[model samples]
Target chain A: MQLRQLSLRPFRNFARIDLEFAEGGAVIVGANGRGKSNILEAICYQSIGKSIRGARDHEAVPHGEGHFDIRGDWQQGQRRHPCRVFYGADDGKRVFLDEAPLPRVSDLVSHFQTVYFAPQDVALVLQFSAQRRRLLDIVLSQADAVYLKALQTYQRLLTQRNHFLRSLGHRGVDPTEREVWDAQLAKPGALLRHHRLLGLVEIMPDFARQYDVFSTGQETAGLLYADEVIESNPDEIPTRDQLEATFRQQLRDGFEKERHAGHTLNGPHRDGFVFTIDGEAADAFGSQGQQKSVLLSWKMAELRLLERRKGQQPLLLLDDVFSELDPIRSAHLIEMVEDFDQVILTAPRQPQESLGDRYARIDLE
Target chain B: MGPEPLEDLVVAFTRLPGIGRKTAQRLALYVLKSPPQEAESLAAAVRAARENIGHCTRCFHLTERGQELCHICRDPRRDTGMICVVEEASDALALERSELMRGTYHVLGGALSPLDGVGPEDLRIAELVERVREEGIREVILAHNASAEGEATAEYIHQRLDGMTQVSRLARGLPAGSDLDLADRTTLAHALQGRVQF
Candidate 1:
């Protein structure tokens, strides 16, 4: 799916902004913090009901405003569609597809499989495992509804469990009450882990191939799920039997401790995704350039996977990421996106004369 | 002018997960107006809780003893042959309200969500299977919510089990799109009692 037009009202620095996209591609050019990222943020908000920068709903409102609104016209498959998202100070946020209210944010992901690249994406390789896991999640969630549902359920349980833990010491709750939460938390948690392991298995080969492209075939990349319960032994990845047994044992052992401490400590929240280059941890050992290349390869693999699965190219949002890379990497990125049906790139300035005339630029002041 | 302590309090509060600036200010003023002893106790409570509580070695549940086993694991009356699986410990408590499940439980910590980058390896799935095998569990009930990830997680477990033992899922009594914990006690109890074979 590709965005054809976007309209924003009191969103970020844009008081009332309307912009249209060409059939092929559009380049948004602006100085730093001149509402360039805001425009992209608006698109992301309408598509996914959240900001790429992790802005809260109220934060998305202009500095002095209490409400923010975004509307987008897009083409998915053979049909043209209009989608809108509105956030208000008094009321909760709402999403509309072709003017009809959606039941959930996951419904929006069904319409548009968007892959965004921000400068922070470089951190995918260098930052904590959560970032890398998020990278995998955004891509896999769009591709599979089951994955989205599992994630939602898992997170909801985690929040509830933590809340219970927080209240345990203060509230007059029974000791047995904690057992109930343990039983409920385990089922989905196990299922979530199963899905992640499968997703990595399915996407790892593709990730490796793309990594080779970005790394000039000098590095071999691999993704591994690292957890005390799942694969404690590097030589023998624990079988499902072993993993489940460990889970039960851990819960059994921790029951009284959970009540005493008022918190659930074990599970996916503590898990990490391990990225390796030639059997070495990437985050600890990879250089800045290598990290960037790893992230680019992962994102490119995401694009290819979505295109293959959806039978349509997704709209690509590149948010001022070009400045972080060298000219060669920038050129490689440009070449990678050349065949996309729609690409929206934000940069400090227009590309040099060498980029030719394939892209249309829009200036934001 | 000196730094505005009130403003700093508001900013700090806003940094929390859900608290906004306005709520933060309300909280700060409440603390400021409270008795000195109360404020000191609150401060002491925060530090004491963080330092005293830690994960149980056996179940990974938070505790103060730093012991290997939790209370439930220590309970001899609970059914050891049956295990109710869930995303977090809170679900275990919600189930306990029904008083229908007599068996023990295993907390996996989360459901499989590939998009959010959560996977089986992130959760406690392997440990769950191990618990089942080592404990001689006769039945494993998959109690994840009825969502895509929940179903996928159940399927993944079913595949891994490979008929080592019977595995079932919580029945579809809860609303099509709803959370299990949010369901009323009656609904949750019924769902658990009516679980179906996976």
Candidate 2:
């Protein structure tokens, strides 16, 4: 899916803005802190019903306003569809497709699988494994509705289980009451790990290829599904039996500790994905430039994965990511957008000398 | 007569679950004027339970002694062949109030949902299957909610128990998508009685 036009009303720094794409791509160029990122964020919000920058609904609203709305005309299949997202004063958020209310955010993912890349994404390669895991999850969640559903269920159970644990010390409450939560936590917990592993498998080759292109064949990166629950064995991936046995054992051993901690501890929340280069952790050893290359490669791969799975090019949102890369890397990144139907790039200023007449420019002054 | 102590009492009360600042103030005012003996008794009751009560070893129920099974699981008269699987221990109490099913239960801890990254490996499903295999359960009754995650969970358990034992799910009487904990006792009991083979 590709976004044709985006209209924002009282969203972030943009009080009223309407911009159209050039069928291929459009670049929003302005100085730093001149609301370029805000425009890109609004477009991403319109597509996913959440900010790529992790802004709360209230924060997405104009500084002095209590509400914000984003309207987008997107092309999917052979037709152009209108999608809208609105947030209210009461912190309520709603999404509509063609004027009909969407049942869940996953519904929107199928039609508007926009990929967003930002400077912070460098953390995907240089920071904790959770960052890379999140990168994998965002891509996989958009590609598969089942994975999204599983993720939602796992989060709900995690909250409920934590709430129950906190209440264990309350008077008249039975400690054994937690057994029920333990049993309930396992099902979703296992599904999450399974899908995550599957996600890694699907993205590994893409990650490797993108890393090679960005790194100029200097490094070979691999995605590793890291977890304490997976026993040290000859198996590359844990079997269903091994997973179940480990889950049961962890539940048995962590019961008392969970009760004391007032939260469930042994599950996917504790799981991470390791990024390795030549059998060494890349995050700890990779230089800043190398980290940026790794993240860009992964994100570009994400765009390809979405395109391949959905049979359409996804909208690309580059939020001030160009300024962080060298001219050559920036040119390579811009070239990748040629395959996408629509691309929105946020930069400090138009690269007039490099881009020339290739991209339509919108000055976010 | 000073408001200082009264304010502290209100804050403490508000810290309790489900109690708001207004309710906390009202409760604190009532307690402040109550007899000293009654106040002392309340404190003693709280401490007495904390020092004594513990989880049952066999059934994992909260009890004074952790030696034997919980009352429900220990009762020989209850049906051992039928197990009502649930996500929380409070659900067992909710089920018991109706007195509809005499069968015992096996809590699965939680349902299958992967969004927050929870998977089958995080819960006690293997123990449940083990219980079924070891005890030779006649039927495994799944009482998970009807939400997407809940349905997926029930389906996963059903697949796990394929050819191992007869598995069933609570009927759709409880509504198309509703949590069991929120269902009324009558509706919960009806759903339990009308369970269909998976």
The stretch of ten residues in a row with the least summed lDDT in candidate 1 chain A is: A227-236
Q: Write the per-residue lDDT of candidate 1 for residues A172-244, one digit (tens) a residue.
A: 5433334444555666667666666656665667778777767754878876676322222234444545565
List per-candidate RMSD values in Å: 14.0, 10.9
Per-candidate TM-score, first chain only? Answer: 0.87, 0.89
Evaluated on CA atoms against the true complex, candidate 1 attains a DockQ of: 0.03
Best by TM-score: 2
State fnat for each of the candidate structures: 0.00, 0.04
TM-score for the first chain in candidate 2 comes to 0.89
lDDT per residue, candidate 2, A30-129, as tens digits?
8887788777787777666687766677887777788999998887767988989888986488889998987665567656788888865576435865
Error of 1 at B162 (Å): 26
Residue-wise lDDT of candidate 1 within B62-177, one digit each (tens)?
Answer: 55765566666667898888888887777887887788988877777877653464555678878877877788889999888765457567766766676788998876668778
Candidate 1 chain B worst ten-residue window by lDDT = B54-63
Number of clashes recorded per candidate: 69, 33
Interface RMSD of each: 13.6, 11.7
